[model samples]
Target: MTFLGVFAWSPVSSATVTTTLGVDPGAWNVWRNRRLTPAPLSRTWFRRASGSPLVYQVSDVLVWLATKRGEHIDPLTTWRLSLARDFGTETSDPVEIRRLAVLYARAVGPVIGGVRFTTAGFQAYLASLLSSS
Candidate 1:
């Protein structure tokens, strides 16, 4: 099952499903944990694996995200999408998608992998995701 030319294991509920690509469960599960966790979602093991602050501008993907608009995301959700944008991936064809993916991952990787998220942080992230615009 797929949609929007993006491959997925099954069709997504239009209002809920954001991701199109079918990713390995291991990573997504980790992502989900962080996404749902409150800010400061566990900071012990992932610290070493963490990288520098996400490079939002370097990737073409980031630029694309700047243009995109969506219902504001809770911080974790916002962070999740951002991370995927930067690090998750893109179909290896068009230059545009690739670029967008990079930017997103950079925005998201820290909270998803590095920081610990709390419920309050989640709300803040969501507030941001849902643009006042």
Candidate 2:
């Protein structure tokens, strides 16, 4: 989904930053396979070391949900599911969980604007989500 327009002014110039947050199906597929595919003998290592699996899985589910519902799922829900899967049952408070999710989306939205995808970017995104609240 598209974000509300943001305005920034400098002494010499000004610019508006508008970010759209959504996964492009083809790009996401390529990124998911390339980044989430574990080494044949190191699946456990990969899962333990990174949140790529959670991100990949949640992205798929979000895509499905969006298609089935015929509307874009907000970033907050996307972040919430990813956080829940990555953290398991450790974080169970609905209010706190949503607050954390919203914080994550706010912190990471600018970094992940547009249609770009990268493993490092995804990891950083997860870091922001995990570190919040």
Candidate 3:
């Protein structure tokens, strides 16, 4: 005698997953080097102002430089030096110097940080003084 048997079939399913991670050592080195290096003076405004012949140009630039380096500059003394440099002792007018000294003292804010001066006011004052002279 012979016997017959039947079997059922079923389908199978599968899935795949992938992941990646990496870092460049050179990038870390560049970042570290940048952090350790001091910042260079790249101020374009300062460069432009340096070329001008205004009475306070030199003093303004000096005060700006001092402020950038976290220091202070005496505005009165700076103004005096600037005047002397721009106009030698032989040519410097005592009355004009005294007037400018008063203007500087009025415009200067304090002795702590960066000195402040009103450019328009100073320019107008200078123009008037020169026109009168």
Candidate 4:
């Protein structure tokens, strides 16, 4: 079920979700591993191939963000909304999303949950997550 006309039924990388939400990769990892984040479609829709990256339902992510707003989570909620506001709720351009990620990341500083989340760190994480695919 697609909402906001973004990813629809498509698979979204963890890095795309993390960068789009402006959250540190480590926090994202923790959230998913702890079940704080919604389960990805990969969990039941189909078996992911041995080396493919896990994918999430964009609608699930949006709903989770909308309801999880709090002191620590508010900033991420803001970034999620900002993408809709700045580029329309339907916007899903990777280039623009990454551009906005850079802008927002700089303003907030690259540290969250005590992890130093530089662009390099993000790129590295993305590489690692995608490398096996």
The C-alpha TM-scores of every prediction are 0.21, 0.27, 0.26, 0.42
Model 2, span 1-133: residue lDDT tens: 2123221000000011101234454554565468532112112212232323222222333344476569865434554555655445346565666556546555554333222235554445445445433
Candidate 1 lDDT, 1-133, residue by residue in tens:
1133221111112111223324454554465467531122222222232332121111122222333444333323333343355348434333344344334433443344223334554344333333311
lDDT of each: 0.31, 0.37, 0.32, 0.50
Off by over 4 Å in 1: 1-61, 64-111
RMSD versus native structure for model 4: 13.1
| lDDT score, candidate 2 | 0.37
Top-lDDT structure, candidate number: 4
Report residue 27 deviation for candidate 3 (angstroms): 25
In candidate 2, stretches whose alpha carbon ends up further than 4 angstroms from where it belongs are: 1-79, 87-89, 113-133
Deviation in Å, model 4, residue 8 alpha carbon: 4.4
Which sections of candidate 4 miss by over 4 Å?
1-5, 43-51, 70-133
lDDT of 3 by residue, 31-102 (tens): 436752212122321222333311222333345446767987643445455556444533245465557654
TM-score of 3: 0.26
Candidate 4 lDDT by residue in tens digits, 32-128: 8999996764333233344444566454576677667642432233444556765475445554454554554344443422233346644443333
Candidates 2 and 4 compared by TM-score, better number: 4
